[model samples]
Target: AIQIAASRDQLDPLLLSQAPGISFKYWKDATQLYLQQIDRLVAKGEDAKLAENKPYGGPVFRKMAVQLSLHDLKGAVTTLVDARLFQEAYVLSRTRYMDSLAEQTLRLWAHDCFLNGHYNTSSVCYMALGDLSQAAAALGKSSDEESLSLAADIAKVLGQTTFAGHIEEKREFIKSKKELLEKLDKQVEDQDLKDLPSRSELVIKENNTEKSQLEEPEKDTENAKEVASTDEKNLMSDTQAEESGKGEDENKIEKLLVELPEKMEGLLKDGIQNGMHKGDGDTMQNGEATDPQNNNEILAKPLQNGSEPVQEKSATE
Candidate 1:
């Protein structure tokens, strides 16, 4: 009921009195309500005199209320810190004199910011606490080269020579690392370029090999064709020579056949003449008169039978 009334901004003196008891259990809620009420009253230009004239009257009551409110606010700030709400806790605590609580909250907030990589925020927090060294160190965590270099210059101006030198050294290291990576990349590109011609040559050699492999059968076929043509030519020449030799042999045989009858007739005539001479000599020795007609018949009979003429015998034999 009290929380409901607080939320509605309808909390009376009766509910406000119960807030102290609520602080023991729900201190953060109670503190928040009390601070809101205080803010409202201040905004309305309410003074201590107006506060005292209310049902919660008297200076003693006012003082006790202030003390209790302070205690509750402190508890609320501690709760926020425990919840890792350091920024809220720091802001809440810084508005009042919470003794060492504000400084503790600022430190916690700075550390949280640093861990979360809010380097600039952490550096501001550290600077607010008058910690120049920690502030410069926080700024050094930034990735920007120009920011790091600027931070180094700022650190030097602020009399933090050691931190400035560290920042400068880190900046140089980052630059050198980047340069080295660029050089390595360039070298890899150059190597790839250098290998391109050899790779092309290898491709050409492979193509030539494949072409030769494909043409080998054709070359073999051409050689076979040449051999076949040469064989055909040789066979043709041999046939022509054989035909020519046969023609010459036929001519020689035909010539011999054509002259054969003439040669036989001349040999027959010589044999007949010798037979007549022999017959005349024999007739003279025998003293017989030669019958020319009978000799002629004898010669004619041999000629008719195609035989050589026989010599005439003596009349005594």
Candidate 2:
């Protein structure tokens, strides 16, 4: 905190209590220091005589006044007005010089005091301070061309009618702003809602396509199972037919073997008789020679007699 000395005469009890809610710890410290200094100057011995000398009086008084002005920022306007009068008196008596920066600061504080809680004060301050646009902007009026035209037309109707007419007009302006914002919010909601259906539809379509794709494989698997079952049946039937044909062929072979022995017996009997007849008739030709007709008759005799041929006669032929 800054600490500067306040003059004893400038100290006022009511000023501290009447201060607004601004921070003024520096001023309180300065007041305490000034009181201590006064107490030191009035002390019993050597410092008392030194305090009466004019050597450092002017600078010290000026410093004390600056400290008083800093505190005055927290004071009421009435106290500030009294301080300004006091300052003017001191200047007139050539007791102290006013600092330009300090004077401007006091004026700014005075302006803040007057302007507190007043819109017109802000308007005037900004306007005089070469801030016309800011002054106009601070009024909270709409700058949009359409709103401005509407406000003007409203004002014109108010001029033609009663002064109170524009009160309702102002309410309408607020309501219109709210409605416009609501419409924009609803439009955004509608766009969001639109995107939802498309997203859901896409998801549904994809799910259906995937379901169809999965079902197709299942159907194909069923067809393949049926085909495999049919092929198995065909293979089993073919095997059964082959086994039956093998059994029939075996039976036919057994039947052929039984008939073959009987046929062979008839041929052997016919051959022996024919051989003897050939031997008697062909004796003149040669002992080993035989006629062709007699040879055939002898070969047939073995089968007719149903007996084995005689070994002696067979050897001679």
Candidate 3:
């Protein structure tokens, strides 16, 4: 009723003055008046204003009611957007408000000619609010590559690796484009597919270039194949030699293992026989040394008489 009366210019200031709390009388704005009533409701422990309540009614009524309670920031954002107060609308879109959803919307809207400044301002707001990812993204939209790089660096310092990486890539992409233009002396007039270095052609060039240089000794395809074949043959020969060396080492190890038992048994038999000879007190004792030839003859006589020791027999077996 008040709305209709006010719209028709039939509402009187004297009637509004009588209803101080119910009207926007002496209030800075309608939002302030609505918020005062909402505060009263909160003091009484009433609900329906907070975001979790999912307040009923359409966007218009809901927006007015939602801001009064300071919940569901998107309601205010939507309302401001509908009113075409894009600067204020974008200012409210942030991490504390709608998180990344608002950022995504602002990023898209920044492409507009009118709202482009708003996007840059929003970026400054985001940076002041310490959201480097959003700031870098906004700078990119404004084509400020250098500032974008700086924002990416700030994000890296703050340990936002994923956001920093994405921002850095955008900066690098712009940088590469600039470099390519400079290298071409700003002659971007080429339209032929063969002249342009497309991504697929680059991949093919890399794969094909790895094997042969542009200027090589062997130009003929058959000669190149033959050289490759020769190199392969050399590799095979080296491998075969290594295998043969390993086999020889195994055989030598086996031979040494077989001879070890025989050597031990022979030493044992010689010690026993020498002990028996010592017991006889025949020749070597005290300071006297036995003759090598006589010792050999004595040992040989026992073998010739078909009386070889068990140690010798086991060793042969």
Q: Identify the runs in model 3 with alpha carbons over 4 angstroms from their true place.
A: 1-80, 88-119, 128-130, 137-143, 162-166, 182-317
Expressed as tens digits, the lDDT of each residue in 20-124 for candidate 1 is: 553566755666786787777678786342244354444433444554455677767766777777876777677767748999899988999999999988888
lDDT of 2 by residue, 1-317 (tens): 12211343233332333232234664465557556655666574535443343332354434444445555332323343444443333233232243543444344533453445433444455555554444443332543444434434544443533422443455467778978999999999998877445788999999999999999999999999999999999999999999999999999988777666576655555555565676666775675654556555555544333344443334335
Kindly give the number of clashing pairs for every candidate: 0, 16, 0
Worst 10 residues of 3 by lDDT: 308-317
Work out the TM-score per prediction: 0.37, 0.25, 0.25
Each model's C-alpha lDDT?
A: 0.74, 0.51, 0.59
Q: Rank the candidate models, highest TM-score first.
A: 1, 2, 3
- Number of residue pairs clashing in candidate 1, backbone atoms closer than 3 angstroms, sequence gap of 3 or more or interchain: 0
Residues 1-317, model 3: lDDT tens digits? 33443444333332233243344453334444445555665787753433243223445544544463455566667776666555566666763466575765554444342254654676766665566666666665554687777767767777877977887787788889988878786455443334668899999999789656753555687688999999999999999999999999999999887776666557756786776577446433444444455444544543322233342221111
- How well does candidate 2 score on lDDT at residue 98? 38
Pairing residues by index, what is the TM-score of model 2?
A: 0.25
Position 305, candidate 1: lDDT: 35
lDDT of 2 at 200: 80
Candidate 3 lands at a TM-score of 0.25
Q: How accurate locally is residue 14 in candidate 3, as Cα lDDT from 0 to 100?
A: 28
lDDT of 2 at 63: 43
Give candidate 3's error at residue 177 in angstroms. 1.4
